[model samples]
Target: MLIATHSGKFHADDVWAVAVLDILFPGSQLIRTRDAARLAEADFAVDVGGVWDAAAGRFDHHQKGFDGARQNGVVYASAGLVWKEYGGRCVAQLAHECCGQELPPQRAQEIAWAIDSDLVQYLDMADTGSAKNAPGGYGLSAVVSGFNPTWIDEQMAGSVEAAEEFRLNQFRRAMGFIREIIINAVKYRVGALLALDQVRQAERLEGGSVLFLGNAALPWSSVVRNEMPEVLFVVSYSMNENRHMIHTVPVAADSFKARKDLPKAWAGLRGGELAAVTGVEDAIFCHNNVFIAAAVSYEGIMRLARLALAEPDPRGA
Candidate 1:
């Protein structure tokens, strides 16, 4: 199998599209060219064939009269065009390889949609001039495009062949970077889906006001905030630090205001000072914002949680 894309310069869209194909069709040869004969002979033509037929493995969006857009109106670039067709399979394969789980077809499509909404669409937006690069130029699209050779570097190469060779090397580097992004995206979504049941079954304490999770690494915020409405705070064991942590449940996603905040008296206190305030001898520290606190033992954390629960919200009775 041969994968062919345009030569000269590369963008995140082309790199991402090619990377997906390369991953799905392993052992495929890659060539950088615009020659129609060469592109015609390739197994897949990406970003340069001036076509958008997925069944034929032609995934270019530069053709005339192309008006492909998502339901939300984001225009399709080569990346989006290819991803719309192959993303589910890519996600499934990555989940099996990187996460050791074979996702169902429906589940794989769900994760693919998430990646499209969160990451792929932005690459398309930037590629099509529909949106600006993320502020501070830290966006993935900008980062990937940075891999392209600069004019000075091309001049330094001193010949078309040397410059094209250098560009191809950089293109491969960019593809490697994009490939990692895809794997991580798959791993994260898969892990979150797997953790949902654990979050749902986490032990409830203090009359269900406090939730306890054995593993702090589990993603419980969305579950706790949305599903477990009665849960005001969560206590979990931090394996990394070998400590116990209590966290205030936020009122909503990404909101700073938690459903309940720790007592004002405990704010910013640490070590013996926090212990004195809470009377939990092993109490470690409380954030000044009172959204989080830590203790050396489960008993200490539970005690702090009970005290905070009994304490009135300073804003009102």
Candidate 2:
């Protein structure tokens, strides 16, 4: 019989679980990875068992699959027993146990009280906070609404040292690229009208950004939503003397589309040549006119511009 447990963290319970499982079935291999490829060979699996409290007679059965595995193995015991015997009180307790030292009574009591008072809920809330209001469609407004100004005042007034916190570095990097794209588009008068239209569309999409570029005979232009992480770019240019077209580029799927010109003057701007832009890197340039745009990632734009530049100039080339 094989028993497999998976967890994002190597907690004390994880170590205990492995030790108990090993004692039960010697020579069973323990494996873990952030990649899915590592689990391809496993035929059976068990999810991580949550914390168990014996003092208060409470068991956190939120995790699934443990009971079934236990029944199949004929162990048939609850998490409470597992935690009481094997789980450590805290990081310190875990370290002490590993070092062959007994956990202090005060620390043990703290862990017990933590479980009883649902301190895990606080940790869970912090984890959700780190997600930056993305979970459950909650926005910054929701977070601000629940925040306590008094707590902030207390923390600032207290003697204890406080650590500085900042938003995820990746988010800042993405925003930098967004700002560069927007400023460049505005400076070149690239897609002002289309940008406005895309902003309206994004408003309809519930605060999603859409990049728009290309119309009549202009270069690409992008528009991003104010609150969401999205980009839309559009490109439109004339392909023939009688026909004008419009094209739209979505960030995801790298998709583009073109449609035939309608009777109205703006109709020609409706359908431009469309192509999936790919392999764009740090900078994008139009070889024909030497037009260049720089950003953290411009691989998609570069590919589109190069493709357009390669096409024979309909007038003569």
Candidate 3:
């Protein structure tokens, strides 16, 4: 399979669209050109063919009279156009490759829409001049644009062929970065979906005030803050660190403030000092901010949890 995109320069939209196709169709030949015959012969024409047919694998929004937009009115760039058709497949592919799960068709589509909403639409927005980059030029679109060769670099190439070759290499680098972003996004969302049920069924202790998750790696804060309001502290065994952990539940998803913090006396204490203060022989360290603490054994963490629960809230909530 051959993938043809426009030559000379690249943007996030084109780079992202081509990256998605390259991932789905590995080992495809990639060419950067505006030659009509070359584009006609390619299996996929991205950001150049002046066409917008997904079934035919022609993904471009530069054609005349183009008015493709999402329900929320974000215009379609090559990124959004290709993603609208292939994003679900991309999600399913990544889920299986990265998370080792075959996501249901509906679930895959849902995640695709989520990625579109969270990321693709913004690329489209920037491409169509419907939105501006972040003030500091830190946006992904800006960062991708930065990968283009500067005038001095192009001049140093000394010839059109050398400049084009250098530009192609940069485009591939941008593709590699975008591909990693897609992989990580799919992995995190799939992991979150898989963990929802486990979070819901986590063992409740201390009259439901403490939730014990068997695996500390599981993401529980959003579930605890949103659904399990009664849970103030969570105790889990961290397999990676080989330690038991106690975590204070945050009052909101984005807030750093916890619903109930560990006792102030235990703040910044570690090892023997923490054990002496909390009276848990295997107690480890408590973070200075008191949002989390650790112990060597489950019993030690449980004791710490009980001690924290009995202590009056410093805020007197």
Q: Please list the C-alpha lDDT of all candidates, in the order they appear.
A: 0.93, 0.32, 0.93
TM-score of 2: 0.18
Candidate 2: residue 255 lDDT (0-100): 28
Task: Please list the residue runs of candidate 2 whose C-alpha ends up more than 4 Å from where it truly belongs after superposition.
Answer: 1-3, 6-28, 31-86, 89-101, 105-107, 115-119, 123-317
Model 2 score (lDDT): 0.32
Q: What is the Cα root-mean-square deviation between model 2 and the actual structure?
A: 23.5
- Model 1 residue runs over 4 Å out of place are none
Off by over 4 Å in 3: 132-135, 314-316
lDDT of 3 by residue, 1-317 (tens): 99999998899999999999998999999999999999999999999979998889999999999999999988999999989999999999999988899999899999999999989899999999989646569899999999999999999999999999999999999999999999988988899999999999989999999999999989888888889888999999989899999999989877899989999888899999998888888898999999999999998899999998998986879
Deviation (Å) of 112 in candidate 3: 1.1
Ranking by lDDT: 1, 3, 2
Compute each candidate's TM-score over C-alphas: 0.95, 0.18, 0.90
Give candidate 2's error at residue 50 in angstroms: 12
- Worst-scoring 10-residue span by lDDT in model 3: 129-138
